[model samples]
Target: MTDMRNGSVTLLEVAPRDGFQSIDKLIPTAEKIAIVEDLLSAGVSRMELGSFVSPKAIPQMADMKEIAAHFKGREGCRMSVLVPNGKGASLALEAGYPDLVFVVSVSETHNRANVNQSVAQSLDQLRAIVAEAGDGGSRLRVDLATSFDCPFTGDVPLDAVRKVAGEALVIAPAAEFALCDTTGRADPMTVAHRFEAVMREAPDETVWAFHGHDTFGMGVANALYAYSAGVTIIEGAAAGLGGCPFAPGATGNTATEDLQFAFEQGGITTGIDRAKLLDTADRIAALPGGKTASHLRIVPRGRAV
Candidate 1:
């Protein structure tokens, strides 16, 4: 049975990382900082501010180091960065950010396409990262990419996802876990089932997160379902600006504003100001060449537009 617990949820604002990385045009570092400041002011307690990947691979994230430097050790906000491989994890640890997110695909094909490695190889990388983060902050997390559906292979089997997740738990037992719908093809039924079954496996885990995209317009619904299934952390990007550049046809992430609105309506506490979040969404949407898909950001705000 699903928990359906609606007391509260942590919303991880991911515009600075996931949302910005998808845009083609370069958003000046100053602008990026400004956006982060705005997000913080909106009472966003946690966020994914950047990634520790190669500059050549992702030009938008080339300034990740500087961004980390500026926000390093800030109290109150739990800022994390995507660390794909061992090298990235090493760099992040050296840069004073032992907290990291290591992503591995449940689908073999998408794993090879996203990080140019097999699933086993990615797990090996996770082991190395876990070892590096052994005694420190140990904020390591495994993002089970394509946990629900994969663009290349279509719907991924839940057993495959569980196998990979089990291996990941063995690699980093104390680390957090996030089930990612890489292609946004997941429906509420699958979301509920996957999280429930996985959560049952780790009854002690209270920090499981759900990362979904809005490709099929079920982003909010899927997230709410995950919440019911006992997920605590919900990842959303302002303006819904994000997609897997590696996953063909995938769209932006579940919008932060939409999630807040849906949960707030049910009296779910997120500690975010709706007006400020909407304002931040507007700023993100105005970015040149930035594709957005949040319904709240577009609708009339008292006919002010």
Candidate 2:
């Protein structure tokens, strides 16, 4: 927990969950495992290992238990599993992940459309989840999705996003909170302004992270804006994987390679091996429809794969 306000940076690799789950073709479990392993080998210290929602809702994350079981106690790296509610949180605890991330959308329309729950309902679920995880000696984080703009409900009011984040923190009291631009509607100015506002209104030093999509092709710009605004932990996918099934035509996340490049070129140190990361991206590219959206793909650099 380095002081993010002190200019330290962290990147949470999100390809295994957010990246693969959006595509029509299901990436094999073995491949998913390999990707996670590869990312770890590349010096990515933290990763969004998997999600705990029902397989019916997101079949790609059905193997969460298996993945969680496999990642338990892997040295040096910390893995986080996403939980949608108390049930998912229980499953995460059962699977033995010490770190958990709970997601709640700020937009009512997006919340109902994504999880079939209202904002209040989702907060209530989060309270239960926090209690459950606390009983199990696990840590929890809350991600406020659609904090910027909502596809279903145009521009999401900043107040609504702030309120949901505050409720989540109150339930867990000390849980970390992240803001996500699910549909990638956040511009640089919007990202800077919103994140600054959240920092000002947050209770204590909130563990703030940014999850930005590349739908409007401004993912990198928004992320850079977030970085400039003092956000450290940035969630992104390898090979630019991930898109919203509900918000059709929305592009994938900011490519991990792209984000890394931005940080490295800007004189920021992430402790991640650029060559290894690019190699992993190439491995994904070799997969059917693994076509990468990152700029590194054109460089023809060699590492592995």
Candidate 3:
């Protein structure tokens, strides 16, 4: 059964990284920093702040280094950046970040297209990153992307996700594993069933995370299902920002405000201030093309002009 207690569940805000990357407008460094600061003040402990991918591919994240520099002295925040390869990993380490994250698609075709590397190649790189992180203040995590379904490949087999997850466990024994529904193709049933099955396989030494896209509007439902299935860490983006530029017709992520409201209303305490989160979402919506995917618009404190 899913654990829905205070200490049992954790949410990793992904708006700064996954959410902003998919947008066409360039979110200035100051604004990104301000948003993250707001979330931290609202009591979000862990957040995916940025990605270390090639600037050419994700121009939005090109300022990763600069942003990392800004957070150098911050406290009580576990900031992480997504690293695609050895180079990206090295950059993360050089930035003095204590945590690094890697993502690999469960679908072979999507893995190649997204990262220009095969599953094995990506796994090898992750292993190298783990080795480099060796006994430091930092930690490594590998997100098993497309665990639900792939845009390129119709349905990803559970066995395939398990296979790669197993291999990843060997390299980074202490690494956390995240099951990503990159295409938002996961339903509540699939989430509950598959996640329960996969959670059983997760090594006791590792933590488990769930990253669900809201492509089909099932993100929150799937998240609730995962929570019931023993997933502790839930990933979400602010303003539901993010979609694959290369992946056609891809939608944004599950909105942070909406998810927080759902959790709170469901009698689940996420230790987050819902009102503050809504305010943040509203601010983002005011930006150019910033109308977020969240429904908590027109907050009362501020005038809605």
Candidate 4:
């Protein structure tokens, strides 16, 4: 059950869903499929393949069902989709995805802006989802967005984060939980403090995860801090392809290659082929209006593969 990199960190490739959704234009479904397949072939074992939100709201993910059907039985990769609400959850489950990521912001203002639901309403919906999924059926990963800071409101309190996460864990005790830096405004200290504190509140059965953005260029550092705080599952987008709707013109989620390079260098293996990962990233960044910003991609270093 062990491998080379000491406390190995697993990565969840989210470019297909998180990254592509940021681009204003709709990427062809075939291209989306190809990119996802390439990421898997590059040795990414976990991923956010797509989402089941209303196509009217996010035209980019309109073809999620088709994408799911294409890679239904693919081996060596665990893929999931973002489900905004009960309907999205039902649709994703019907499409054959048992791994579902349900997102809620700790900041009420951000929650309303992000999902049009108040924080309390989101918790109620999550309670329903946990009941529907049960203890052993669908795997639910609740993403507490804006855990560190909100786009509409600046800094979020640690107590508020713990409260929301506690409420969610109470609803889905066996489910995985992710603290997300939706605005990319988290410093390493806050990342560490929040994760360390929040982790203390969860049961031993809960799996901790970190989802960070790169808007302030602290994505990699924040992820490392989260990892040091005992989070194993880290989420990133290829070529840094996702941007928050609240922070326009800002960079996207943490880059997959950046994470791979950072973790591998720290003796924490990610199992991603560096060269192939970069090439895949390059191809994705080449898409029309595709936005990307990654340090390892720009600077040549000893780790360049």
What is the per-residue lDDT of model 4 for residues 156-231, given as tens digits with 9 covering 90 to 100?
9999999999888878877888999988888988898999899887876678999999878899999888888889
Which residue pairs in candidate 2 have backbone atoms (N, alpha carbon, C) closer than 3 angstroms, thus clashing? none
Per TM-score, the best of the predicted structures is 1
Q: Show where candidate 4 strays beyond 4 Å.
A: 1-5, 136-138, 247-250, 300-305
Residue 6, model 2: Cα distance from true site in angstroms: 11
lDDT of 2 at 242: 80
lDDT of 1 at 80: 84
Q: lDDT scores for all predictions?
A: 0.87, 0.81, 0.80, 0.85
Off by over 4 Å in 3: 1-8, 135-138, 298-305
Better model by lDDT: candidate 1 vs candidate 4: 1
Estimate TM-scores for all models: 0.95, 0.92, 0.92, 0.94
- Candidate 2's residue-wise lDDT over 1-305, tens digit each? 13223344678899888887876677788888998899999889889898988888898888788778788889878788888888887888788886888778998888888888999998888888878877422367788888988888788998987788767766777777788989887898889889899888776566678998888878888887888887878888889888767665578888888888787767777778888999898887777767788766665777532
Question: Every model's Cα RMSD, please?
Answer: 2.1, 3.4, 3.0, 2.6
Candidate 1 lDDT tens digits, 188-295: 889989998887777475369999998999999999998887788999999999988899989999999999998888878899988998888888888888755888
lDDT by residue (tens digit), candidate 3, 115-135: 888999888888778777775
| Candidate 3 global lDDT | 0.80
Task: Specify the highest-lDDT model's number.
Answer: 1
What is the Å distance of residue 126 in model 3 from its true position?
0.9
